[model samples]
Target: MKTAYQQFISREAKLADLPALVALEQACFNSDRLSKRSFKNWLQSTQRIFMVLEQGAEIVGYGLVIMRKGTRLARLYSLAISPTMRGLGLGKQLLIELEKQSVAVGKLFLRLEVEKTNQRAIGLYESMGYKVFGDYKNYYENNNDALRMQKAIRHYSNFSRLPTYPWYQQSTDFTCGPAALMMAMNSIAPKVTMDQKTELDLWREATTIFMMAGHGGCHPLGLALAAEKRGFSAKVFINQALPLFTAGVRSEHKKQTLELVEAQFAAQALQKNIQIETAEFELSVLQNALENGGRVVSLISTYRMDGYKVPHWVTITAMDQDCLYFHDPSVPDGHVMGFDCQHIPLAKEDFIKLSSYGKNKLRTALVLYPNFLNTSLD
Candidate 1:
């Protein structure tokens, strides 16, 4: 007697299973594929859930759901099936499973991006009742545009009456891009005797500042002032070639504000004479600051596939021989509020090479000197 397809097991993924998942991802994606480190992060993320399908002890497929609180939508990050089993309805089955999982979590909508050129995949998505909501040009660097599709799972509710404290007031040890920004702004009081290890604390501080400032919920300049008061240095990285604003007053206004901030830092440098360095890459700027005998504090912007999407910010605090420590604002307070470093260490040369893969949009790192608030305008 043969076992039925329905008999194949499906279960939540484990850390030990990451190697197989990594192998499967490599088999399905190009060199620009998600890294093993990223896989580990996703596996450990509280906001994410992963499932795998197996047949007679062989892994055949996997799916991921990213559940974000304070928002009604859930994202289907990726769904993949083994090459040998592509034609079977396994992919559709995985999608159905994902829908069930997300709906159980109170999500009102499910969304995913499909390669526009993959007609077969697009057909599958559409047949499943997903409607094309938008087109993201060059969404995937390895491929062309991507079709942003959405499926309504429930009625939308207005967020006007919801309490803001539970979501925004919670203090996390480890932070993600958005939450870190809020904390950094709220916790700005001066400290004495800066810890040499404080550079390692850069992640949470930088992430909080950037997230709050960039989102317009808090003033960027005010956050910078608070960092100075708390004995932590700060800098804001701005790209000269964003191409979002043309030669006009809006562009000029942005440039002037950045320049004004830069002037304030320059004046601070003159007093303490602390060197502040800025670079296009977070790792590079931090490395430069360390080599020159200065601790680094930086704000880094996440890459933008489309301008309308939310961008993330991260901070860098300290660096050892190979690993750098900082905050990642995406995790809960227990995880994100403290200093963290790369689990997998990389050589300086290797880090530079890997960072190059996602260099499409303007990515800049702002370095700051800790302590002393100063104000300026230009």
Candidate 2:
């Protein structure tokens, strides 16, 4: 699609236009500029939406948005306007054009980051309905921070009908389970505190004592017990009754200790009225629970999201016809901050591949309900 303002028009960029695009990007930013090879790569990539604005056949502004492999969200990687083209509304026009391009490819949200000192750019984004969700310190080449921002590109979204999910970042690497649990609980009940004190407290409550290395991770039953103790209704789902993640530890004594801990967590869950289901979890069961006003904390393999080949925990808030949106407590690698972790819009097809972890493909999750039934998130 081409949008024109008299002689100023926007259209897709071609490979031959690489030099002009690179020149404009260099002229716009003093640091954190994209390499010429990067521009060429993006230009040739099928996942990239590259658009250039032209004034009387001269390239004046450009924007690039990239669609991820398995998700329904797009990232506005970069945008630039010629030095003389400032204040002509070219930036806004280019941004709008790029948003349309992203939506055309079935993306639900358009996310990006901008230098914090560039208030004009941030103002332009905010004025256009973008909201700042998180930030990254010392993100730019010159040590300037970047404010993470995004806008729901779709005019018709079903997210409003779902519960309001809060996002939290895990202070330490191993506390993802506790962090995800906190977000899920707070989403249903606002009284749930998310400070580091609560995070560490829950970790202390649920750790399995020995994992693949170092301190053990939180077991599914352990997480459920912690949630139930906090006055929320919880149901644990797992395929096998055998203790989960024993393969993570090689020591026979450590494995036995983990099994005993899991058994204790199981007994406590039963004593406290937390239900445990040992059947294989169908995706529809998880969706149905959410439809009936339940929050979920699930174990996922990070390989799909970042190739980490490790087990991680995340909270599931809601789902729409096209995508599954959740709050991940840990920020993914290769990112400046946890911006992309908040309300992440991943496709359902890919989520199935992500929700299971390790060999034997263990599937486990905890579905939770707030203390007071019918809690109004509105």
- Top-scoring candidate (TM-score): 2
Please, what are the lDDT tens digits per residue for candidate 2 over residues 1-378? 678877898889999889898888888888888889988988898878999999886899999987654467788888899989799888998888888878888888899999998999999999999887677899888998998887889876655333446889999989999999999988777888999999999999999887787777898888888887788888989987777888768889988898899889888887887889998888888889998988888888988656677888999878877678888887554422466666778767778888878887888999998767534432
Model 2 regions more than 4 Å off: 1-59, 66-70, 86-108, 113-163, 334-336, 372-378
TM-score of each: 0.43, 0.75
- RMSD (Cα, Å) for all candidates, in order, is 19.1, 5.3
lDDT to native, each model = 0.51, 0.83
Across residues 223-253, which tens digit of lDDT does each residue of candidate 1 receive?
A: 3443554555665444443321122224455
Off by over 4 Å in 1: 1-5, 155-378
Q: Best-fitting candidate, measured by lDDT?
A: 2
Q: Which lDDT value does model 2 have at 1?
A: 68
Cα TM-score of candidate 2: 0.75
Quote the positional error of residue 9 for candidate 2 in Å: 10
